[model samples]
Target: MSREKLLEVQDLKQHFRTGKHSVVKAVDGITFDIYKGETFGLVGESGCGKSTTGRSIIRLYNATDGDVKFRGVSVHGKKSKDDLRIFNQKMQMIFQDPYASLNPRMTVMDIVAEGLDINNLAKTPKERQARVHELLETVGLSKEHANRYPHEFSGGQRQRIGIARALAVDPEFIIADEPISALDVSIQAQVVNLLKDLQDKHGYTYLFIAHDLSMVKYISDRIGVMYFGKMVEIAESDELYKNPLHPYTKSLLSAIPLPDPDYERTRRRVEYDPERDNDKSEEPVFREVKEGHWVLCTSKEFEQYKEDLVE
Candidate 1:
């Protein structure tokens, strides 16, 4: 991973007022950085605010607090229409649901060319058509499919179209929000591999948000674990899996099932009860227990983690 930061999210918070008195903190005070030309995977269970983080960063929803910066420019506050347009061109997002994200009324050509049209990337109609076709092919779809509506395509094909649409603007940073989660098991690997191949060819930076740890490990240079709208751990992909420091992280890693029958039978699930594990006396803070490995813990727990690592 490059030392250069492409995107920086500091203390980002997104809260929703569900009722007059009740509020939901979808994302609360999370901080992380995505290095240029590297895939940073954000993993957590559903409702853990991983997806919310992506949406807030993309400016789909206004954050309640904190800041998000792209190459040193703040994305949260107000900007001119021209500036917003430039940010939109540089940063694109792939939504979780292929069926819902795509327009049922529009043809694949129109859908993929939407970005091109908005940004005026292509001057002529012929140029636009050619660019759409090229993007379709890049995502493993045929030129013939351009005339078809989103409803005609299968889940995997629809996702490819979504990817094509995102690529239309040639974005430098892509936020893939559970891009493969809705696909079939067999199709999931194909989509993930396609994303990896595209990143490799284009040198695109990614904030890959997903629940699948194994796939995250395969694609990401660095990984962050989130729980209850807060980041619990952050480390290099292999390091996080090998030496998970947080209870929640351990619980998540332990749940991944192996193919072997013997291993499956012997596998133990670690249940993390926050009420039990979390020390009430001291507020937990994100701290580095080892070089490049950070975890949210109280000072006492931080010392314990470091000592345990030494043994």
Candidate 2:
């Protein structure tokens, strides 16, 4: 991973007002950075605000507070048409549900070419057709598949269409929000491998959001564990897996199933009891307990984590 920062998210909050008196904090005060040419994985259970973080960063939903900077420019607040256009071109998103994300009415060719059309990336129909064909092949699809509608393809194929659309504009960064979760288990690895291959070919930076820790660990250079709309741990992927410091992270890691039946039978499951672990005296803060590992903890818990690392 490159040391140059590609994206910076500082204290991002996304809240929804359900009623006149009720509010939901979908994403509350989270911060992280994605470096150029690295895949930063965001993992948590469903509804843990991982998806919301990706959407808010891409401006799909207006952030209620904090800042998201791409390169050096702030993505929040009002901006000129040119600025918005630039932002859209530089950042793209692949939605979670491939079945719902694609327009069933449009042909695959039109779907993939939409971004190219909007950005005027291709000047002529011939150029557009060539670009669409190139993208289809890049994502392991054929030129013949382009004429078919979304309903004609399977879930994995539909996701490839989504990926083609995202790459049509040649974006520098992509936010993949559970792109493989909707596919069959057999197909999931195919899609994930395709993404890794693409990233390898084109030095693209990624904010890969998903609930599958095993899959995330496979593709990510760094990983951040989220809980209840807050980041509980952040570290290099292997480091986080080998030495999990946060209770929630340990609970999450312990839940990953192995192929060995013997190991599965013997594996110790650690249930996360927030009531027992949380210190209500003071709210815990995100602090670095080691050179690159960070965890949300109070001073007392921080000391304990440090001693645990030593031992």
Candidate 3:
């Protein structure tokens, strides 16, 4: 992957106000970069703001605070219609639920060609049909299925349709918000492999959001661990897995099941109770505990991590 940054999310926060006047901190101040041609995995438990982060960067939700930059252009900032149109075409998203993401009223071709239609990428009806057909084949769907409704397909096939739609605009970046979570375990691999192959062919960057750590490890070049709307740690995939710094990161890694039966039985899971565990007085600062590895911690923890490296 190139060292050039494709997207930069700086101190992003998304808050929702409840009827009771309480603010829900869906995504509170997380920062990271996705390098060009690399999959940046964001992993955490349910409701940890993984999807919110993806949506915020893609401008699906207006960010409450902070900046999202794509190729030096502010994503959430006001822009001319032409610039916004370019932004819309360059960035795309794939939702978690395949069944719900596609419109039942539309055929697979119409759904896949939605982006092309909106962007006026195709001029003629024949061109649109050919483009849709090409996208379907690219995602491993048959041309015969192009006229079929989403209800007629299985979960995995529906997701393949979603992928085809995301690729319709020829996006350079894709925010995959838990793309495989709703699919069957057996079919999940196929979808993931399809994504990997597509990336290989197209060199697209990804913000792959998921709670499934194992699958994230398989697909991600680098991984960022999230907990309760905060980024706990980030590092290269194997480095983060082998040397998890934060308590939250360690706890998350411990939950990943081992393939060996003996190890699985003997492994002790790390428990994380944020209330009793993390210091709530001061806000956590992300520091480089090692080169290319960052951990959110107080000054004391940073020193401790430094000392541990020496020892």
TM-score for each of the candidates? 0.98, 0.98, 0.96
How many angstroms is residue 127 displaced in model 2 relative to the true structure, after the best TM-score fit?
Answer: 0.4
Residue-level lDDT tens digits of model 2 in 4-101: 99999999999999999999999999999999999999999998999999999999999999999999889999999988988999999999999799
| Model 3 CA lDDT for position 122 | 98
- Each model's lDDT comes to 0.94, 0.94, 0.92
Question: Model 3 scores what on Cα lDDT?
Answer: 0.92
Clashes of each: 0, 0, 0
Where is the poorest 10-residue window by lDDT in model 3? 302-311
Please rank every candidate by lDDT, starting with the best: 1, 2, 3
Candidate 2's C-alpha lDDT? 0.94
Q: Give the TM-score of candidate 3.
A: 0.96
Show the colliding residue pairs in model 1: none
Which residues of candidate 3, in runs, are more than 4 Å off?
A: 279-282, 309-311
Cα lDDT of model 3 by residue, 138-226, tens digit: 99998999999999999999999999999999999999999999998999999999999999999988899999899999999999988
- Which RMSD does model 3 reach against the true structure? 1.7
